[model samples]
Target: MSVRPLTEDQRDAMQEITNIAMGQAGSLLATLLGVFVNLSVPRINVLALSDVADAIGSMVGRNIEITAVRQSFHGYLRGEAIVIYGRDGCKELGDLMGYDEVLDRTDEIELLLDVSNILVGACLGGIIDQIKGITEAHGAGELSFSAPSLMAENVPAEVLINPDKLTWTHALLMEVNFTLEGRNFISHLCMLMPGGSIEKMRNILDEFVASF
Candidate 1:
């Protein structure tokens, strides 16, 4: 089966979907952190396999501290979203987690996973509900893989997915960045959609935008 590459329009639509999704995420994050959260124009990119390391490297270099959370969801749709939080953002989060001091590398990872468990879950829930018409707009938090060392070590981890199950036929990596105040947050949506689902995703995204 030939992979149906996303048209520029589809990419635009996906970015819009992320804007909505991340807006909701930022709001929830604000409530969690007890700070006013401001979001910047989200940056979106789709990457080839070779570029993955470069992409992650650029983001991690922006700050010495990094925290990441990852969650996996499956049903009519299957994929994962790994949310990366910056060093200062982790500090803000550590404060929320009731740690009276800075989080060590391990502490940062745990905090990131916990926070991502909430924010990434909510973002994916909204997107899945909108696109798939599957009302299972929820996430079951599980630790597929996570490590504070992954961030503190300044090394990027490659995402592992069942390549043949990916919806786009090709293994597509959708990434978007969120900047609130002066801190940057990155959300990586790694979707493994079967080839049959792209059209449905387009339709759902269209309907979602029309309703807005």
Candidate 2:
């Protein structure tokens, strides 16, 4: 389905809500690892699925390979959340939590999935909870998540988000990256909602702004 883009007011409202959600995810990670989390201002875009790679690459770099985790969420607003970890992102995570040695292949994937799953649940649930409070439009629905699994492994950034494989045509993309101060670790949390859900979000955002 083709949908018109969100107006500037709607986009700004989305950016602000996404920022809060991002911070919630970051705070969870910081608490888990005992390290500070640096977050970027969240960006909200209504983009074609084919344009998603470019959007992701600009944030995490196209040349480097990434480790990613993917999970699906269902509720008032539905979408998939993909967490992209930089080349050394997982390694840095291991070090931060006091791992004495490099993790084995299975151990690495397990760790990656676990952390990303928690983050996806926190970030997406945060937005849904806040939006529902602001707008009763979707308040009746319950939020839930599927298991997070590996999406890409040492894969080039360009092919990580394969639009051709996705069934949706367009998405409302909200993205933010988390970094450790003075560390090479970087991970981007990207949430994409289909065109159908965008309509609900538009209304929710309007309600959110009016509530202020």
Candidate 3:
């Protein structure tokens, strides 16, 4: 069965929280890459694990090949964040970020991981701060993240996520993307939280709404 894990109020509040976080992420990326960053509206939903690949495709475009990295976060909040880059693999970013020579496969992966670390860390940090402010217990603990690792390279988005291999049936997806103005660089950050974390998000959000 299809699932909607978050109510409308929860979804909207989360979107606003993520909007603030994404803007922070974009600012940090722009400073790092030495290019103007374009931020997309945060898209929030609860979707089936089976449909995540298609949802990713819809964001990045149909069948477009991609490079991606993932970092898993745990603590008071839990989720895995996937950072997706387009098929050209961010040569533009390398140039803007002061890499004068062409990046070999290893160098490219390293660059992607560097960018992923900044984006995921700043974005999640912003959201966590807000959640801590609103969490009723006031003891909402901090989140800790694993180092970013390469997930997929130059693969079609449709095949990027395999549903059968995932442990969860449904996830709350919070997605946002950053684009570099006048450069061939775009990155989509998709944060997927399973049922346990979804319940935590719902509780925190309810407290937030009640306080206002």
Candidate 4:
């Protein structure tokens, strides 16, 4: 499916919305880890599934072992939200969460899911809340989502890029990076909205901007 690229104005508005959501997510992480979370400016882009890896590498660097968890959301818009952690970062997270000295594979997986649930839920909830606020303020319908489940983890980027895994040919990708101050931990949160929902989001963003 062909979709128009987002205008600068639209991108700015979306960036602001994503910034708000990322702030909420950062706060939640700070509370969970008992450390300050430094967030980079959110980035918005439209790209095909094949191009996602390059974008991620640009943010997280190259030749890193990445672990990601994905959760799908639906309502007025539908998409998948991914929380990615580098292998070393995952170990740091495990330590911060107070895991045992030697963690088995199962233990590591559990920790990853636990953290993923917290981060994904907080981020997606914040986004939905903002969207709902806009719609309610403008007298539009509410947006909602289902409970997030662990879709994949510790999977290679190449494995993840299989055509069968990506339901949409293209998506609007929003990325936000988080770093734990005084620690070696870094994480990237990415949200992908399909072309169909991108149009819906664009219309809603237009209405949102006009209201202000």
Q: Write the number of the candidate with greater TM-score, choosing between 3 and 4.
A: 3
Collision pairs in model 4: none
Q: Which runs in model 3 stand beyond 4 Å of their true positions?
A: 136-138
TM-score of decoy 3 = 0.95
Regions of candidate 2 where Cα sits further than 4 Å from its true position: 1-3, 134-139
Residue pairs whose backbone atoms clash in candidate 1: 166-193, 167-193, 167-194
The TM-score of predicted model 4 comes to 0.88
Cα lDDT for residue 29, model 4?
91
- For candidate 1, the per-residue lDDT at 3 reads 44
Which structure is stronger by TM-score: 2 or 3? 3
lDDT of 1 by residue, 1-212 (tens): 44445666666777777678767877887787666666555444444434444555564454344445555555444545656655466666676557887678677766666776666665665565345432233332222322212322232333222234333433345555545454444344333333334455555555555555
The lDDT values for all models are 0.53, 0.85, 0.86, 0.78
Regions more than 4 Å wrong, model 4: 1-3, 136-159
Ranking by lDDT: 3, 2, 4, 1
> TM-score per candidate, in order?
0.64, 0.94, 0.95, 0.88
Model 2: per-residue Cα lDDT over 1-212, one tens digit each: 55578999999999988888888989999999898899899888998888878888877787898988999887777898999998788888888878899888888888899899878888887787688775565445676788999988998877887888888888888888888988888888899898778888898888888888
Ranking of all predicted structures according to TM-score, beginning with the best and ending with the worst: 3, 2, 4, 1
